[model samples]
Target: MRSEKEMMDLVLSLAEQDERIRIVTLEGSRANINIPKKNDLEFMEEVLIDDNMVFDIDNLKGFLNDTSSFGFIAKENNKIIGFAYCYTLLRPDGKTMFYLHSIGMLPNYQDKGYGSKLLSFIKEYSKEIGCSEMFLITDKGNPRACHVYEKLGGKNDYKDEIVYVYDYEKGDK
Candidate 1:
């Protein structure tokens, strides 16, 4: 397994070299009262666990039923290297936007620039599917990821908003 630093390095390198990647932005913030002080790694671990439990076959079937929902994986020699989950929807004004829910590379593939490849694919695929913009969240303490987003020309103008989340199966709090 590759260290987090190595994965970060590759993500940054790809952002630097890729012209298709635009608008990289951090998602998690210090003001997020739900998650106090978890760093990127910790946040990712929690997300990984949640995804495993949430993306069961039945859930995926429902997700697939929604035309705006999409998921993709990066593979090399038939081996999975990375994955992305996203949802694109049309607003009341007829504008289309997508939320990049997750993007992650396997530890062993982190340094190989596969994350960038996966992101690139997401951009093109989103465009192909009629999306105009995409957004994602990253932890505030994850400077490495923030740097990559900045390098990719992502803007971070949002500030001071509380994130409210409710899992469908877990029911409302």
Candidate 2:
């Protein structure tokens, strides 16, 4: 098997090169501030790449196949450290847009600008595809992610419950 770091680099580089990949987001318990317990497969399966952690692939695939999704894991050396996943939706106007479903860096990788690098790639991709805008939903609970988005020039467009809609126009990226 390839090293985890190698795998992460591959995923990010591929996303950087492909315009069809409009955005990269993350999902699952990893987005939760509370690190998940290892005993359950449900939470584990929600993550795209668990590294040495065991998860139910069949369950995860089933859940994702029902939607338009793309995911990537970040690695350093041979170890997996972070991930992002995005879900696409068709608007009533017949325009296609994608949401930044989830994004997370492993505890050790946080605040190191890796997330920005990934987001930059995603934004550039969205522009190349002629997308009008890109959106992301984050919680007031996850202020760190919000801060990151703001630093990247994201605008707050809407919010309901804990979900905050961070939007970027096509020309800005």
Candidate 3:
């Protein structure tokens, strides 16, 4: 298992690479003014890195300049344990969708309900903002997250698409 710091570094690096991911915020104790209010940054603690690293706050800000990004944090007792990053996009059908880029909790927090709660919040918020669909892609090796998503009513149309989609369109089926 990767250490907490290593896992967090991977998460941050992925977010930086994905242009769709616009916001990066930590949840636990401190308030990060960077993440927008649309996505609740309330739970997990923020990512803390050693000062020796070259990357700094200014670099992060420069990367996450788009205003359309949003994220969530899962925390317990003022300590961050997990986080999620997402972004919105307009589909070819002229409807909007929320794409869950990444969601993960620390090893100690796994099997707990934190992941479910965070996803639930994101689902509800997506509905509130008129998203016609919300979806995510998780590795097939990670059955735990897949189970959670299935339990929350996401469809298993992952055969060829490799995506779990939650369609909210009305009366089109």
Candidate 4:
């Protein structure tokens, strides 16, 4: 565990390097994870402990039966190393795109060329399927992901785009 000051310094260093991080501390806002303020980590743990999980096997079965989405797994000597989930999207222009998500690789395989190769394969597969575009969330904070996407000719048309997420069905008071 790092001291709060050390952690702050590290965050400052990263913010300096990332243009997406416009403001640093002494701008004086308390983050949820900040040492002096709310502990979202503990909150997350408590939520995990308190919430009862119920899996809908029928829903999963229906999804498995549905088309228009697929996953690509990268394997080496019969061992799966990486995977990317993609869903087909039909645009108003009558062209299709692949909405890529849930891309992941084993920790030992990460930072290797396998991730690049897997992504490249996905692109090629998308092209083969007549997809006009591929869309995926590549946050600039993830410099490694950005680097890989850039090498693959991915474009960022909008800088500093704000994303809004709506979480469903949590009883709020």
| lDDT for residue 14 in candidate 4, whole number 0-100 | 40
Cα lDDT for residue 93, candidate 2: 89
Over 1-173, each residue of candidate 3 has an lDDT whose tens digit, in order, gives 65545544544565556443433333443333232222222221233332223444445445356545765655555556667767788888899999887787777888977777778777877797789989888777989998999999999764876444565664343
Best candidate (score: TM-score): 4
Write model 1 residue lDDT over 92-167, tens digit each, in one string.
Answer: 9898998888877768767455566566556666777677787788887888667666666667888775567787
lDDT of 2 by residue, 46-154 (tens): 3444443333434443434554665554444434456666666778888778677777776777887767766766666556655667788776778888888999989
Tens-digit lDDT track of model 4 for 135-170: 888676899988888888989888878776665666
TM-score, each model? 0.62, 0.57, 0.61, 0.63
- Model 2 weakest lDDT span, ten residues long: 29-38
What is the Cα-based lDDT of residue 23 in candidate 3?
37
RMSD of each: 13.7, 12.4, 11.5, 18.1
Ranking by TM-score: 4, 1, 3, 2
For all candidates, the clash counts are 4, 9, 6, 0
User: What is the alpha-carbon lDDT of model 3 when measured against the actual structure?
Assistant: 0.62
- Cα TM-score of candidate 1: 0.62
Q: Can you rank all candidates by lDDT, best first?
A: 3, 4, 1, 2
Candidate 3 C-alpha error for residue 85, in Å: 0.5
Model 4 lDDT on a 0 to 1 scale: 0.56
Candidate 2 — which pairs collide?
Answer: 4-78, 5-78, 5-79, 25-84, 25-85, 25-102, 26-85, 26-102, 26-103
TM-score of 3: 0.61
